[model samples]
Target chain A: MELTLGPLAYHWPADIRRDFYARIADEAPVGTVYLGEVICSKRAPFHEPDLPATIERLERGGKRVVLSSLAEVMLKREREATAGLMAAEDHEVEVNNAAGLMDRGRRPHRIGPFLNAYNEATIAWMAGQGATHVCLPAELPGHSAAVAARAARALGVGVEVQVFGRAPLAVSARCYHARAHGRHKDNCQFVCEDDPDGMPLLTLDGKPLLRVNGIQTQSESYVELVEALPELAAAGVSHARLLPQAVDMVAVARVFADHLGGMCDATEARARLAGICAGVSFSNGFFHGVAGYRHIARLGTAH
Target chain B: MTGAEDFSAAGELVCPAGTPAALRTAVEAGADTVYCGLRNATNARNFPGLNFTPEELQASVAFAHARGAKVLLAVNTYPPAGQLALWHEAAAIGMRAGVDAFIVADMGVARHIAETWPRARLHLSVQAAASSPEAIRYYCTHFGVRRVVLPRILTIPEIRAIRREIPCEIETFVFGNHGLMVEGRCSLTNWLTGQSTNLDGVCSPAAEVTFERADDGTMRSCLSGFTIDRFAAGETAGYPTICKGRYAAPHRPEGYYAFEEPVSLNLGRLLPELMAAGVHAFKIEGRQRSKSYVRQVVGAFRRAVDSIRSGHDPDLADLVALTEGQKETQGAFQTKKWR
Candidate 1:
């Protein structure tokens, strides 16, 4: 199965963002890349110059790039952006919500992790709307993903999973940055530039809790499916999306790529991933239909 | 929009005010009734720099009353653990200030109001997300909710279908940032940060955000710390929220909005259609907006309703500049093929 690097949910500097994609374009073994500003309309202009360049570089280097739509509600500026993305000539688009489906252009489009695809009917419907691939929401269970995958395969729609990185659990309208700094959303001084990785929160007992990303919230632990890969491949998932995190991401991508390429066994892959990703926990809770933070059968846990 | 007006108007209009200016704006703008909560978490819009101090609310109530407008105190916040007293006190003081009713959402708050003042009128808040007619009827029977503000996810057909089975006046968001997708129970905000619009009555707490000019001439905006959106130098930027930002997917080599883009719901054109669908009252969003906005938009909608009643086409104004980054959308109201 192909490995897709999901959008960088963190706002890295233009150079850092460029270099990140550049590295992926040249060195990383991933097959696909999805990129764009999916949170606030203000950030859309930042990546304009670099996005086309990176897309061209990635395409020249043999990586397929899919443009994405926002995952939450829309405002006018966002609508224009959506229209522009839908109107783009060459690449396919990943629709995060159903809003883009109303005016989706004739492209081999896919569905993003949002749109609340809770059941098989929604998946089947996306296929009818001309979705070629669909990534299930992070909160969906593995069994549900499998069920949706079977349906997708039947309808000729490719199914993907977020096998690594923190789970994107929810999106919101309120800007946490402005709220945190005692500013209204309109006057937010662009304070979110301080943290490249999302702002981290800890429980009262000092446990790593969650990371805030503008209006979107994500999990503290990364999710990995090294052991579950065989099951997922057998269940008809076409690809796996690896979200680039703040640390060891290149190495992390290599580990997954190695596993996918049959260069490493499941046990070695898990071990190498653990060595590179120090101390941060991994969860399949969303796939297992349990609490999102809980890791079932953790690495190094006595069986 | 579908069907004729089925439910007769009952109870009153319960509006919102983020500031005292908005309170006056709502009052003078022809609000039949005005609703607000204390500066604490007694109401849902508990973001900073909003709501009323006890004295201001009391004064605002007097002002509204002298102008023949009724004040409905919204003590609708869910009570935090072991903190029922804060909600209780907000309700008690609202009653003392001669509020016409208590717009309550939580069952605990409803119980508190009932036990404290048996004669008080209580309307159900939209935080309850009671969609089915059976569900709303259950609230009316148990909590004595005089009215219900229906969630915006419903179409006119759905609202008319609901009118056939409910026993309360229906209020729908007419001109405002209608949250079409998010349900009341979502924690996408809380999961990223420690605060939430539901638990804390706040979303995307400002203290956690930062934005910077990336070296590549792209501007990146983030909430908490996650990149919500990135804009090139020429593109317009709205407030940075995660769901509205563009992200990359494989299908398109270019980046796009992977969740949703930030769009405001401006259903100005659909007023005639929604009115025919048994809607008793229309609600405008953005208690967090400016007084000038409050005066213009609310007054505009008020006039729209009057114009509709007089069987004239409503005067249309391009109020886009009043919006965040001046962006607005018809949302899900106009599209029949909406997924």
Candidate 2:
């Protein structure tokens, strides 16, 4: 399976954003790079000027670049931005919401994980609409992903699954990050910038439960599926997406690449990942068809 | 703004029907329309011991139509991989049963209905999360949707602004379980319990839930072995859905409702404002509630609509007792303070 770099779900300063992409383009062993914002529209302007240079640099480095649409399109400006992306000339557009579908028409595009393609019929229908690739939602178990991947392969569409980073648990029109910081979504004042990753939210029992970004809520535990690569490959998945995180992403990509290429074993790569994953725990329970917070390893047997 | 003359006509009163008895009760209680689903993952309220069978759906549709009331079939949940045929079969069965409209959420399912049954009237489910006019228009234009049930996150002014922009009709929740999370976008319960509200129509599946009393004489509601909420000695413990549970945040060391408090949504006081905002239908959201809940809520809303039509205010005090925590709020309708 090939490694694909998913979009940045958080807000970083323009310099950080640019430098992060530059390092990925130069050092990361990722084949496809998805650029642009997928969370809040208010944070787009901070990185819009750097987008062209970053996209050009990635393309110049022999990486396939795709522009991602917003996961939640509520405002008129968001809709217009989607339309503009659909009408763009250079890169493939990943449609995240229904508005993107309206603007895309029959053009070749990619369907993001946020669009809710749960079944084979949905994927086939999207394929009919000229979608060349489909990213399944992060909550799907291994069996469900296998079924979807089989259907997608039959229809000549590539199936991509999220193999790393925190699974996006929810998205809302209201900004929980701003609300936690004592402000409304309308006047969030870019407070989400304060948390480079996301603001951690704890349960009543002092257990870490979730992270609140601008309008998006994510799982507190980062999801890791390195050991599940055999099952994923056997299930007909073509690409494994690694979401950008606040760590040595280049090393992250290299480990996944080495593991996929048979250069390193699962245990060695996992030990290396554990060093950089920080104090946060790694979970693969959703892939095992159980609670997402639990990490169940099925090493010797099929799930 | 909608003038008094136009607002006096009163919007349609849509009620929920989880069981056959609830369906008949809602129709008999003056609900202009009653929505229901088949006993499977085809609908959003796919709880055990609830919903109608195919035979029951046909009978219920006939019962409602014979009384001049409409029956809308809810095929709203997103179908899982290799399981789209179940949703398709449900819609086909609903059409054969002569249902009035199909409430669909997934874009693929909507497209299938639009292509297969071009004459079928379609209503965008709240699970589709079409909060903006552009998103509503996309569904209306692409799938021939006739109406859209707006998500619970918008304010009254926001709904009015959306009404002015979109072509299809608009529906809003009048009362019921307050889903503080964004409709169709939340997966907190699925992350805890294997059952998914998006794919399986269940949030906090009862099969995985256990309420236990602690040694300190307090109550703890656990879902899949995770402590969702801890109730004090006398505090009532409602269903633990993860979102409404009290949680400790960064600065606030003590447990607080970081997301939302356990309260139901009651928009009875804002009936006039909702109608003036150009809402086409008022939906009461308790399909899994009791038959008495269906009767009382449908009857109260019917009376409230009629009272407004007669140019008078409504008396809806009895409905407050039906709330989850015996407390209610307008819930993002009158103000945006909910966040």
Candidate 3:
């Protein structure tokens, strides 16, 4: 199984992003890295100037690089950006929205998780449209993922599943991060930068329910599939994705790599991951077909 | 601006009907088109005690057709893996029922409908979340989609801009739930309740919802055991959908609507503006509401459309009581500042 890094969903400073990618290029045990702004387009300009250098560095480090498009493409500028990305000649583009798919018609591309590839028939249709790889949506249960992965594999398409990081629950036309601060999406002054990981939102009863990052809403707990990696691989999934969070992602990659490589057991890997993402909780219930916020312990590996 | 005569001729009033009764009510109340779904996961409003059976859909289609109204079948939800048979069956039923169009979201469903009938009309469901001209054109080019329902995330200017580019017809939501999140892309309810609008065709499924009276006498609405919102005495409590729920954040310890307030989207005043923007159809969203809601809302929009077509200001009914949370907003239609 191959370890892939998903695009960053935060608004970290340009230099911080550069430094973070530099480390991933050098030390991260990931086979492929997705680079681009998948959330708010307002933050794309800050880090876009350094894209060429980062892509080259990751490529030189022996990692395949793919550019991801925005999850929600409403504005003309966003459409233009999606078109530009779709027209790239070098790096493979991952189409997250329909605009990208339309622009990249019949061209080789990867399907991002943002585009719902929920069923076998959808995967077949995407493969017919020249999609070479597909990362299934985060909400799929184990049975459904297995079915989708098998179908994609039968079509000579690579299947990927997110194995780490907060699951993106929703994307909106309005920026809740800005709205929470009493500002509009237009004049928010880039306030989402304050929460690199994402601003936490709790329920009325004081339970951490979700995280708001610009227009995207994410789960409060990081989705850790250390125990489920073998199950996923057995079900024909070739790639496991790890989304970039505010934590030490390189170390997070190592934990997943070690678990996938059979160098450490699931319990030890979970412990190390807990230490890395110290304060945050972990969940795997989405795979178990229950509420995504709950962590379902494996039957034999209950700790 | 387009002439009043041209606006009236081109614009269509699309209304919702959860059941055969609602379908009749909407058509008789002056809906040019009525959209509904089968009682299954093939449509977004897969609530129990709602939607139509095959026989009911056939009767309703005939009834609407007799009144010079078109019937559209909503096979909108994404079919789960190995579950295409269910949606295909629903489509076959709709076809046999002689529905005028099939409103769809999934590519597989769209491809099936396009390939099966070859000449069947397809309206891109809002759940597809196609906001731009390119995306809409993609559907029109690929599946020969006749019309596209724009997501409730675009402003009037954006809609006008899109109208200048796309080849197919444009449909915009004129009233109903202010869906803050992009349709088909949202899984907040699934994360909390394990049933989603995209996959299961339900949001915060009624089976998972519960209501309780707190010690202070305030009503607490919960979804899947999580407290979504609390309403004071005599305040109308809204459905326990995750997005419109009140939440507590560090910035505001006092609970606030973290995603969106529980307000309905009422574009009654924007009829003339949207008509001027080249919108081919105005859609009302409430498949899970009552038959009376269908009559009142559809009748009100019918009069509004007629009044606007005659070059006069519309005298719309006050639908505040019928709206969610007893309040309404023009939503993202008027301005992006609604964010």
Candidate 4:
């Protein structure tokens, strides 16, 4: 399966974003890189000035780039931004919102995970809408993902699954990142950038349960599917997505690529990944059809 | 103002009904339209003891039609892969029941209804989360959607701008739970529990809810073995929905409502503003509520809509007793500052 990098869901400094993409372009093993602001429109302009150069650099490095739309499109400017992204003729667009789907019309596009293509019939219908690829929601279980992937493959449309990084759980109209700092969404000055990986949200008992990134809520544990890669490939999944987190992504990419390329076993790859993202919890329970926060050990594997 | 033309210019008052009895109550209480779902995972409110059977739906439709009220079937949940049969069966039953419209979320279900019954009126369910005019127009142009129940994230001005761009009717929520998260996109409950509002058609299912009293005399609301919130003794505790529960962070160790407070949304004061914004229908959410709750809320809105149409300010009913946490806010309807 080909490795793909999902759009960054957090806000970072313009130079930081540029440097991050440059490394991914030159060193990371990901085949397709999704670039754009998928979380907040306010963060779009900060990185948009570097987009053309970044895309050019990535393409020059033999990486295919796809532009992604915002997950929430409520404001007029957000609508216009989505329309602008849909109008791009240089690269394939991955639509995360319905507005992008409408603006893209019958043009071939990718369905981002934010869009609810949960079932086979939904995949079939999206394929009818000229969708060339689809990334299933992170909450979907393995069996259901297999069904959706097979269905999309039958229609000659590629299917993608998130195999790494935090799972995006929800998006709210209110910005919790701002609200947490005692500010309104409109007046709050880019406070989400304080937490490059997202601010941790704990339960009343002080257990880290979720993370807040602007208006989006994400899983506290990174979703690690190193053990499920074979299952995904057997299920006809075309791409394995690795969400960009604040970590050594190039090394993270190498770990997955080595495993997929028969250079290492799942056990070795997982151990190396553990060293790469030390002190961070990893979860595959959502793929196991259980609570997303739980890290269910595979049968016969030592914990 | 004459009889039929009195509230003709005003938007349709759509009310919710969880049972056949509630359906009758909403219709008699002055609802122009009543929406309900079947007792299955096909609908978002797939709660036990709520929703209708095929027989109940047919009888309810007849009762509502006799009272000059329309009946709508909400098959709003996304059908899971290999489980499309249940949703399709529900849609077929809804059509057989002679409901006026089908409120749908998934594109596959919309395509099914449009293909099976070419003339069936389709209203885009809020579960679709189609907030932009382009999204609404896509549904209208593709599946002949007559109306779109917009997501609650849009402000009044945004709605007005959207109405000018879309070629369909608009529906906005006027009362009930404060759904701060975007519908169909939230998986907090699904992450905590196994069921979800999008696929399983349930959020924080009642079976998984538990209330325990700590030795310190705190009332703790738990869902799926996780403590969602803790309330002091004598304090009112809301349902253990993940979003409404309080949480802690390093910056605020005292705990805060990270997503939203336990307050409910009451747009009773914004009737005139919504009408001016070109909203064609006002929807009252709460299919899991009791018949009495349905009656009181629907009746209040009914009178309020009529009062506005007659060039008089609405003497809005005191619905504090029916609201969650006994508090209400205009939410995103009044201003963007609510964000």
> What TM-score against the true fold does each predicted structure earn?
0.55, 0.94, 0.97, 0.97
Q: Which segments of model 3 are wrong by more than 4 Å?
A: A300-303, B1-8, B317-325
Query: What DockQ results do all the predictions give, each relative to the true complex?
Result: 0.04, 0.60, 0.81, 0.80
Output DockQ, candidate 4: 0.80
Query: Candidate 3's residue-wise lDDT over A6-37, tens digit each?
Result: 99999999989999999999999999999999
DockQ, candidate 3, vs. native dimer: 0.81
Stretches off by above 4 angstroms in model 1 are A1-303, B1-15, B250-253, B317-325
For candidate 1, the share of real interface contacts preserved is 0.05
Better of 1 and 3 by lDDT: 3
Clashing residue pairs for model 3: none
Put down candidate 4 lDDT per residue, B10-69, tens digits, no spaces. 479999999999999999999999999999999999999999999999999999988888
Backbone clashes in model 4, listed as residue pairs: none
The candidates score, on chain A by TM-score, as follows 0.94, 0.97, 0.98, 0.98
Give the per-residue lDDT of model 1 (tens digit) for B96-187.
78777777766557766775687787777776555556457656765667678776555677777778777877877766655633444355
Query: Candidate 3's fnat?
Result: 0.78
**Model 2 off-target regions past 4 Å?**
A299-303, B1-10, B316-325, B337-339
Tens digits of per-residue lDDT, candidate 1, A69-159, equal 7765345466567767877768888876434554473356888876545345556545765779988766656776787788788888888
Shift of residue B33 alpha carbon in model 4, Å: 1.0
